[model samples]
Target chain A: MMEEGVKKFLYVNRKAPYGTIYALEALEVVLIGAAFDQDVSLAFLDDGVFQLTRDQNTDGVGVKNFSPTFRALGDYDVNKLYVERESLEERGLTADDLQEIVYEDEDDDWAEKPSIRIISRAEMADLMHDQDVILSF
Target chain B: MSTLHTVNKSPFATQSLLSCINHVKDGDAILLIEDGVYGAAAGTGVSDAVAGKAGSVKFYVLGPDLEARGIPATRLLEGVEVVDYAGFVGLAVEHDRAQAWL
Candidate 1:
């Protein structure tokens, strides 16, 4: 259970994965923050939306291909992942092109439901304002 | 409330430090970590930019980062504070938010 004084933490990912370490590092922070039971939400905008694209094959590049770790986020109780609609449209991607993430809600008798929420740019801006801490990468 | 801004890239490597300086508001605090500690060095070209904000904005450099990079505390620009990880967390609590310039 979350503590009474939990602060809203919004991790803004605006960069692409692989070329830079921002994407992976941001994920590490998210996982750590969840362990502290902080109210955490991740926002994917601009090139960051690329981090979630489906069918990422790193065999050619010889990288770890850590994208699959996102699937495990639900178990950490860090399920609020928001992807910006404008970012996806600009990148020529649709929601279906990304990996499907789901979490089991214990409060609802452990029912499974989709975890990724596709939000508009305006909604993202509003969400940004609502955060007590904004970690941008 | 002020915001605690953290920059972890070198100014020579990228414009992350410069961009961060540009976005700082009055009463805000800037903490340099990792390669960003390079900007606090006395002779770096970006020192003038940091020096310019002396009165309005507080400046800080992570001590462990500076030591790891072999940058002595005496070599930092005037008015820059050296902080450890504990101080970093304290600054976060002191400020309204923390913005990491990646």
Candidate 2:
């Protein structure tokens, strides 16, 4: 299951949802890029973790809540979502507060598994360093 | 006259929270809204600064914003109160004036 010329693409999201168009626009770009079949990963740090928080109702603001779209990412084979532990701690958040995103492992008898991975800030830096392309928002 | 100061930016990202803290007078209340709730967490680089002002100024964070950001009330610094939307309105009404730190 090896492919030649496959580049690692990492999308770094650091903005809060609904406050600005950055989070939403970054999400759209990730979805569109999924069609290219690149080795994609998403890194959420700073205020970006707020984008994946549960129970986001935008009815009062009249903006469509696009958080549900993240669940669909697994369908596009973009399931690697790495959240920085230090960022969450600084914001007083835990992994349990985030919306559950699961993907089926084709290699492991189609077993369902979580898509979100909580990683340290240093580990996040290592991840960024290993990427072939990094797109920051 | 007492004042209610509202800060909407994150402490790590901008100077809005710190500036608001520096300028708050005794008996004034500082309300952390939106991304500003990050400043309410315990053991941060700015925790001592916040605690240093605790004796003079009251600190509060919007409950909904904290919940939206997944920040539990238990994770907040000692003495930082969590206020609901109604409480937010109450603070605005209770204070003689309202100041928004942009």
Candidate 3:
């Protein structure tokens, strides 16, 4: 059960990784906020979905590959990642293009479940509407 | 509920403006600020897409941003309106939420 002071915080990610510092910075913010025990969710739309793509090799770009950090989110109780379907389709990408991110459901005998949920654009707007605080990066 | 969508990038340089347009609802408003002011200009490649949504969606451009870019108010599309910093705040207050399309 959520605590009385637990606010619903949504982190909206829209930029592509590597080209700028936004994607990595957003990830760091989410990790730090996870410690607060707030009701946290992440929305990845537009180029933001590129951050979840698998097999990211940053050696050529001389940048650290932080994509693996996403898999560790479940350990922090930071799950419920919403990826927009229309954004992916527009970029010619599919769910298969993304890395597998999952979380363990404590109520269901700690059963493992997928963390990334692919939702439509309309659904994404509704998700935004339901948030108590929306932070975009 | 309505949302105030802010686009701060040039339409020719990025897909932020178009992507925002795709996700906006009928009652929502779109505000062009910074480089986003370019999207308010008329006869551009994406003007039709912006104009088509005019009846249900309200569009506004930041006056200072347009002045900085040397784009006069008359250059804006037929339905696009000009808003100052105070008007920007007003739009934010008027809407249920403000989403910046960065």
Candidate 4:
């Protein structure tokens, strides 16, 4: 549970979603944190950027793929999704390269989509200092 | 010139401990926190590896974590300081940088 009046919760995601539980766990944490009405932001770096990549397929692995769950975040009131610019460039992906975000029509996801900023790792690290609770998953 | 390296997981858990120690400089302080605290009570294997890693780094552990985990202060390796959270924060603010090995 989050503390009262804790505005800033920085969630750092540093692993590939498919390979491990790190990304799924991180996404779950952020949604839960937002449900508690805390100010939350997510930073995707390292292999974590892959979690938002285009067309994630887990069917061949004989398990549920969680890529689509990210589309449900807006419904859960999670709006602050950030991606490191350098990470995308390194992975040869851009905003257009991402999968079609299937969010609810006529929802806050539109207004929130414009606020999804791209930043550098250094910028992300500096932002960590101001967060009330910093969790790296 | 004191640095505390905090190692929480069992030695075999991950490569975080070795990776963290590899990057630490001499005279740095290392504090064992969370799962890293378990490393201190394990055995000489950790000490030998840490000594090799500590070019000049010192060792410290959070007293709260140790006690909560049922690991006694006396059971810790030589030259390891048993301190609290205030001490841990002091180290982070005192030192030039802090890197978590988890």
Candidate 5:
């Protein structure tokens, strides 16, 4: 179990939503952590960018769209969502491209809210440096 | 920096194994977990690649997975350690970061 107050986990979701169970499983871990009130953050990269993309067509594949579930993070008090800038550019997505509220730059502290942050690779390295726990799914 | 990479599938069957072999620095320990345990077989394709990674990376297998698969780590190349699940956590604790190649 993560120690109280010092419990910090950076859950990096790096897989597309439909490819496997990783995306959903990652979300499960986040929700569980939040239920325990642990400090948690999320980062997206690589094909994981697909999880946040708009106009997902999971219907054709006979699966439910999970991209919208991310919107509920704010309600669950789990809102530190970060997307890699390079990954965004490679996919032609800016922070504005995301349909939900998210940051275009790193902001570890946002007034009355969790950071919903964005960052570059170097910043990600820094984020990793401070994290007591990190899980990539 | 230390890295404990958990590979969930076969070396040749999935991209995860290739990614680990390519990115893991020399001296970094690579723990085979899930289906990755299948790679410990000597003379198999994965063992051949693991053998090639000798100086660059070290191979370890989660003991339960190995036992479930019925392959002993001693049968593996000289250096591989048969670690338990708790040891797996210890590895994650000991390493600076973990990259799951799934």
Candidate 6:
């Protein structure tokens, strides 16, 4: 259950994963913040949208493929994953190119629902403005 | 409700500190961590820029990061406050939000 006075927390990701530690470190903060039962939402823009792309193989780079970890965020009740529409288009990707992360809606007899929400840049900006705490990575 | 800006890179190495200082508003607090602690030292090229903002913006450095980098508290700039991890958490809670300049 969400506690009283749960603030809207938004994590803005603008960098590509693997090239820097920002994406991974930002994921760590999201997972930790889940325990507080805050209104958590993640926004992927710029190269950050690459983090959700499918078939990410890190074997060549000799690093662990942490992309799969994003799939598990739904289990922690963190399901508001927003991907900017323009970001995906600029990178030559579509919703079909990304992983399908879903969550079981307990309020509706455990029906599966999509967690990733593809929104426009203006909508993403509005979401950012609505947040009480914005964490950028 | 001031924003807490965290910089994790050295001024000599990256422009993260400079960019953070440029964007921070009045009453915003800046915390230097990791290699960023180097910016808190006195008499550096970046010191003058930091000093100019001392009146409006507050400056802080991570104590553990400074120690790990062999920077003593005495070497820090006059307005720079050294904070431990606990103090780091306090600043996050004290401010309205935190922006990490990675």
Which candidate leads the pack in TM-score?
A: 3
Worst window of 10 by summed lDDT in candidate 1 chain A: A121-130
Per-residue lDDT for A1-137 in model 6, tens only? 65779989989887788989999999999998899888999988778899999999999999878899998998999999999998799889999999989988888998999999999877775676466888889
Runs of candidate 5 with Cα error greater than 4 angstroms are A1-4, A57-62, A85-97, A103-126, B1-3, B18-28, B37-58, B61-100
Per residue, candidate 6 scores C-alpha lDDT tens digits across B1-102 of 678889998999876787567656778899999999999999999999999988899999999999998998888899999899999999999987777877
Candidate 6 similarity to native, TM-score: 0.61
On a 0 to 100 scale, what is the lDDT of residue B27 in model 5? 63
Going through the candidates in order, state the TM-score of chain A alone for each one.
Answer: 0.96, 0.97, 0.97, 0.81, 0.81, 0.96
lDDT of 3 by residue, B1-102 (tens): 778889999999998888888878878899999999999999999999899888889999999999999998788999999999999999999997778888
Local error of candidate 4 at residue B81 (angstroms): 11
- Residues A1-137 of candidate 4: C-alpha lDDT, one tens digit per residue: 55767677778776778778878888877777666777777777656778887777887898678888877776776656777777788778787766555334355545535325677755654555445565767
Clashing pairs for model 3 are none
**lDDT tens string, model 1, B35-73?**
999999887789899899878999999999999989888
Residues B36-93, model 4: lDDT tens digits: 7776663756767765644466778888888888998778877767888888888887
For model 2, the stretches where C-alpha displacement exceeds 4 angstroms are B1-102
Q: Please list the residue runs of candidate 1 whose C-alpha ends up more than 4 Å from where it truly belongs after superposition.
A: B1-95, B98-101
Winning model by DockQ: 3
What are the lDDT figures for the candidates, one per model?
Answer: 0.87, 0.86, 0.92, 0.68, 0.73, 0.87
Off by over 4 Å in 6: A1-3, B1-102
Candidate DockQ scores, in order: 0.25, 0.02, 0.50, 0.09, 0.21, 0.23
Best of the two (4, 5) by lDDT: 5
RMSD of each: 6.3, 15.7, 1.6, 7.7, 5.6, 6.5
lDDT of 1 by residue, A57-126 (tens): 8999978798999999999998999999988997899999999999999899999988899998777756
**In candidate 5 chain B, what residue range of length 10 has the lowest lDDT sum?**
B18-27
TM-score, every prediction: 0.62, 0.59, 0.93, 0.58, 0.62, 0.61
Give the fraction of true interface contacts kept by model 2.
Answer: 0.00
Q: How accurate is candidate 4 locally (lDDT)?
A: 0.68
